[model samples]
Target: MAQPPPATMRAIAIRDGGWRFEEVPVPVPGPDQVLVRTHAAALNRADLLVLDGSYTVNPALAAREQPIAGMDGMGEVAAVGKRVPTTSVGDRVMYMATSAFADFIAIDHRLLMPVPLTLSAVQAAATPSAAITEYDALIVQGGLREGQHVLVLGAATGVGVLATQIAHYAGAATVIGSSTDPVKRTRLDRYGVHVAIDTRRPDWAATVLDATGGHGADLVIDHLGGNALVQALSATAVGGTIVHLGHLAGRHAEIDLDQLGRRRVRLIGSTFRTRTREELFAIAAETASALRPALTEGAIAPAVDRVFPFSQAEYAAAYLTSGQAFGKVVLDFA
Candidate 1:
């Protein structure tokens, strides 16, 4: 028999403008939720925004007295609600959820994904958010087709690495990835990037155009917004789609309206922040169905740049902010 969960658990939270551990009550599973005992949690750039009170997905969270940190995690299911039918108590699962940087998290069961047998806990922890985001950006929103040209901006990022691999795995004819750092551009080759460009150069878009025989990219996955958004327009094919997944550069941008109109480009904005539970559930289901095989076969995997003990989360955040990490940063609870 599985041991019962303790009444309280330690969670990472922002206090006095810094991350620290606090003891909080362990959440009980609601009728449709599952209680997971987390082994590891992954960090995202948004976590930094949340820490500094610069971002909040929901308005309610901004008003909270103490908001726990973290977005996704990997763990063993410790308990399930009566309404959760497919998941059992011992299932190893990875999921996207609020307050994930804790010993326990109660999440909607539908959001849980089975941890692939090939992945360790740290790798599993790095998978959910990046995988789902790239899957949705490339396959769903961007409408990528076989043999089409795909471009990923900030290609060495956690989701960026996955985007390049996914575009290649999905049979893109040529996969182009961009990074401002020359070193990271070289590393992108291992993640199925066929063409690596340094976006810092003035002619980067022209280089993309040259690579595509002046036709531009069929689908563009953009993580850097602001000025990059304008450049992406120059690099995109007529009637192509650009899925704006993040704005690590800057949220606001001024672009040439004439170029967008002339090309008939489709600019889509995607985020989990404001999505309803039903929408998130559907995305999770589609991503799992489409990408699980690739994961099982080891064709695509999350790039974990570093792992820090949960107590060193502050340092982890520092490392990520320093722009030295090429992929995901994870926190190991054990």
Candidate 2:
């Protein structure tokens, strides 16, 4: 059934550093693109960064009166462009990118991944951003190997949780996680963490070392930069890898150069902005393929802490900023 989309659809618009619903023209897919009618979307740390003007938006989009927001979405293919070979109208899918806060989005078909039947629209929407990030950090960049010990800093975060799972699935001998919240720390094992340490403790690194039998971790996924980064460096084993994916704690840090040099640490910084469109498409394709089995078999899942109505995006953003939620906060368009 070919259904004609309305001329305009509601979108969460960024205005005066906040979000509000506004009407925007429904986009038509270009060649090699697909038109999606979104049913759900998820919030990310980038969303907060963008909303606060800390992260720059696309120049052309920033010039708009009301630029759309969001990075992950689940939807049905309402239309497929002429050059799109793999996608067809009516297939359920999920994707990762900005400007997904809109009701309908036209995006490159190559970026779309088939939504597994076991997941709901909200769960599907929650997967792309968190999954791709962890896959890139833990597996691709960090080079986690079977039987190696791994540590996930800020383990209560949505990305942190996924990173732990990826490490576990990769056959890590031990998985250590850190969280400031005791309640959140208690839930880390469910995400495949063998030990959860309170990051607030001054002796947190000692606990991690004890858990790993004083060998330190083979790989460290550091979401918190600043002091946490310094601590993570200390916890990393000689010749180990530490992938710095976020600076949620603080941007600036004074690290020990002598120690870093002695440890032979491979510190890698990663972000979506550094990748070109073609590169992102490739990463999306690779990540989707690698995780499809786990996703389809119900072995891995995104931990959604709360789901808000699409119209209540403002509330959702506030909730995300509160830091009370344990997992991804999603917007339900249903």
Best by lDDT: 1
lDDT of 2 at 267: 89
Model 2 accuracy (lDDT, Cα): 0.87
What are the TM-scores, per candidate, against the unseen true structure?
Answer: 0.96, 0.96
**Model 2 CA deviation exceeding 4 Å by range:** 57-66
User: What's the C-alpha lDDT at position 230 in model 2?
Assistant: 91
Candidate 2: clashing residue pairs, number: 0
lDDT of 1 by residue, 1-334 (tens): 8999999999987777567889988888888888999999999998898767777754321212347788879999999999998999989999877688889988888888899899999999999999999998898888899999999999999989999999999999999999999888889989999999988798899999999999999999999998888899999999999999888888999989999999999999998878777888898888988889999999999899999999889899999999999999999999
Clashing pairs in 2: none
